[model samples]
Target: MQRRKVTLKLYPNAAQSARLEAWTRLHCELYNAALEERIDAWHKARKSISYYDQQNVLPQIKADRPELNELGSHALQQTLRRLDLAFQLFFRRVKAGQTPGFPRFKAAKRFAGFAYPDSAGWRLMQHGGSGATLRIGTGEAAMSIRARGRHRFGVEAKPNDITLTRRNGQWFVSVTLRVPESACARRRTGDQRRGVDFGINDWATFDDGRTIDNPRWLREELPRLAALQRQRARKKGSLRFKRLGRRIARLHERIGNLRRDFVHKETTRMVRQCAILATEQLAPKTMSRSARGTVDAPGRRVRQKAGLNREILSAGFGMVHPMLAYKAEEAGTRLHLSNTRQIKPSQRCSACWELVPKTLSQRMHVCPCGHTAPRDRNSALVVLIDAFNTQHTPGTGVAARPKPLPRQRGKSKSVTRETPTTAPLGA
Candidate 1:
């Protein structure tokens, strides 16, 4: 059994919407209050507060604040659990020699939502189609919400857990259910092994020279986004300003949805087609790091670098690797990631195995050995070559290819492109 989470967009009437907002506010308050208790206990008496230590006093808290009773105990406990997890992560990061950002109190608006740990507080009603009805709480206090979304697999087992989340004024219920692995398996339609290169301009470039054009969603929406920002800047605390903020939020939500939808579809395409996949081990965080140096020495091309970072982030290429990984598991496809820094696929020649450095603007890969192709295609080839026929010699950073490997049985064989081989001509 695999745990699959299905998120459904919820449609609620005015009363239901009000109730959700109230519960969300209550959960946020509980989280903040619990955080305060931990801080005070630690500072005043040098005492550390555990989750159960705070949980044991919940009954008294509910009694003191009767309003919390309507929110359900399981959901309230999950809020405390979230805080405990936050602290746990902080401690773990500290022990790992990383920055341990202490947990800060979240405003009610910042608190997205809350979770129910188990079947106690929620129930899902499936009607065979894509849609379902989610019932929260029980008896007279039960709030039945109409959920609209498509489920990939049949959810027959009891719900593992339920989380109610609010994103940009929209309510979503993500239900985790235990489903059969067979039902979750992806169907493969193609047997070709391929390497993929993700880019900021183009979404993906395959070793075969086929390109999936980048939607450039953020770029297309920028004009309207800029206009809205300009309007909001003119009035800091006005009714029109608040309305503009909501409009901006809705636009952001739309952009996010478009990106997610495209990613899922494209990933599914790869999962269904390729039997073996190779890609670069991209580090988006390192690539998009700020270029602003300290006062002693300032950075060059700050605005240009900032714009490049935005483009890198907007492309959402980092999501491809993880998406391919999980989808590979379901499709029985092999996924390999070549070391980006060491291999330097973008610079290394796939044919001669020599370094062929080129500027970012130069989209064509041209080598002295008469090997040439699109830069991205060559990069994908380098990645694929590294995955199969090359290995680095000990104590040396250079990778050595013993011999040429057999080509993949792909749809279109490359007659024009040079295959990565160390063998002599006509050998």
Candidate 2:
């Protein structure tokens, strides 16, 4: 069995919405109080407070504040569990020689959700098709909410936890269910293999001379965002500014949705065709650093570097690898991350295996042995070749030859464009 999460938008009436907000506020309060307790206890007595120590006093707390009793005990306990997890992560980072950010009290904005860790306090009253109804609490405080979305899991799937989250004034419920592996879509297998190279202008380049164009949604939306920011700045703290802020938020959400949709479709298609895949290992965070340096010594081309960084991030370079990995695992495909340092795909020739250095401005791979192709495409082929060579097995290499795309007469930019080709599974 594997766990899958399905998120659905919740539609609550005025009263139900109020009740949810109240419960969320109570949970936030409880989380903050718990964090304060731990900090104070440790500072005053040099002692650590375990989860159980705080949980044992819950009975007395409820007696003192009758209002909290209306919220489900299971939900409150889950909030404490979240706090415990936060502290655990802090300590883990400390042990790893990383910055140890101690868990801080959560404000209402930070604590926008609560979880039902078990099935005892909540139930999925009606679930099917495009919608479902969720019930929480009991008796007088019992609340039912209508949820809208296409849930991928079946009724037989066991729901392990339900998390209610509020984001940008929208309520959503995330249901984590345990379903049998057999219940998932049929796993695909194939002999076809390919290599992919990620880039900013073109989303991805394949060894077979095809490229996926980057949508650049963030770049397109930035002008409107800037305009909204200007308007908000002129009327800060006014109703007009608040309204513009909401508009900006909605635009950001739309950009995210568009990026996610494209990534899902492209990755799913790629996984189906390539049973064995290869790509250069990348560190996006290191690549997309701010160009502005600290006081002592500043960086050059600060504005230009910042623009390049924005473009790289807008292309969703970081999200692609993880998406491919999980999808490949589900489809029973292999994804090999070739070491960029060792292979140096961009610097090496795919055909002759000779080191041919090129600057960022050189978009064409011109080798001394007369082998040439688009820079990204050549890099992808090099990645495929290096991965196969490193493996200690025969008959595991890809058969497709990298065909160099035709370049424009005046410049090295390739004029040739080809559509992405996907092979049928088991072909």
Candidate 3:
């Protein structure tokens, strides 16, 4: 079965909203109390508290605090389990020689929300005309929230888990459903294969000489954001401060949403059109690292580097690649992450397969062999050709063919040796 998650915005009445907040607060307290217990136990007895030990005490805990009994048992258990997982991660990191961040107490704001491990405690209902509803809790404690989303899950699809979260004063539920893999499978076959070069000016340039312009959403909103921040700075602790704070958060969220939406649409279109996709494997973290130097030594182009870092982050190549990965898997498309060091897509000419050094300021690629093209597009073509260089023979300029497919009992199919068709870099 394939697992898919869909988040739905929830609209709860005043009473229900209050109850949800109360539930969130209780869960926050419960999580902190558990973390405190572990710290205390380890400090006093030099012994670590295990998940099973905590799980065994839940019955007594509920018996002592009757109020907690109102919260579903599974939800409470899940909270404790989350604490246990945190500790497990901490210890794992310690063993791996990484920073072991011990689980700390959570403020109500930080807790976000809780989850139901299975469909037993909650139900999702889809009405023909009235949209969807999420029913959480049981009997008297149960509340039905009007939810906004297309009901994509079918009757046969089972809800495996559900999390109710509060983000920026808004309630949302993420439902994880288990459905047959075949149901999620999309057979998208095509002869068209393409490569992409990612950049700051154009979000991506394709080998076919197509480009998606970078929106620079954050850069565009910076002036308005600065104005709001200035207003907020002057109105500290006042209602105006809180209002502006929300506005700032919403603006940030809007920019993020816009970038995500743009990437999703572009990636989906690419995956649908091509059977195989190729692009340079880039480490955005290393690329976006700060150019600041120590107290004694100053880095060159500090301000310029900072500006470039912001552009890189706003571009969000990290988010784009992962999104493309899963989408390509579902669409039955092959995504090839070419090694950038070996291929050197940006430094090599796609047409003559010759080294052509260019600086960041150079927007066009010019080769001595009379080959020229837009820099990013030329790089994308280099990546495309490199994708087919299976022999890894440097400067071969020969495109390898796809391996022959299997034969069926009564049908004969020719092996496809057709390579990716791209325009000359100069063209």
Task: Score residue 149 of candidate 2 by CA lDDT.
Answer: 77
- What candidate 1 gets wrong by more than 4 Å, as runs, is 156-158, 390-400, 403-427
Cα lDDT tens digits for candidate 3, 119-165: 77899997764379898888887888999875444666777899999
For residues 1-427, write the lDDT of model 2, one tens digit per residue.
Answer: 8888878899999999888888888899999999999999989999999999988888899999899887878888888989999999999999999999988877776577889988877887555578788988888878888888765556667888899999777899998888787665435645677889999868899998889988999999998889988988999878898888888888899999899889988988888767767788888899889878978888889999899998888888788888877677767666767666545789889887767899988999999999989999999998777555544432222222233223312322211111122223344
Candidate 3: Cα lDDT at 274: 76
Model 3 worst lDDT window (10 residues): 414-423
- The parts of candidate 2 lying over 4 Å away from their true place are 125-127, 185-191, 390-427
Return whichever of 1 and 3 wins on lDDT: 1
Model 2: lDDT equals: 0.79
lDDT: worst 10-residue window of model 1? 418-427
How close to the true structure is residue 99 of candidate 1, measured as C-alpha lDDT? 90
RMSD of 3: 7.5
Candidate 2 to truth, TM: 0.89
TM-score of every model versus the real structure: 0.90, 0.89, 0.88
Who is ahead in TM-score, 1 or 3?
Answer: 1
Q: What's the distance in Å from true for residue 122, model 2? A: 1.4
Residue 67, candidate 3: Cα error in Å is: 1.3
Checking candidate 3 for backbone clashes, the offending pairs are none
Candidate 3's error at 292, in angstroms?
A: 0.6
Candidate 1 residue pairs in backbone clash: none
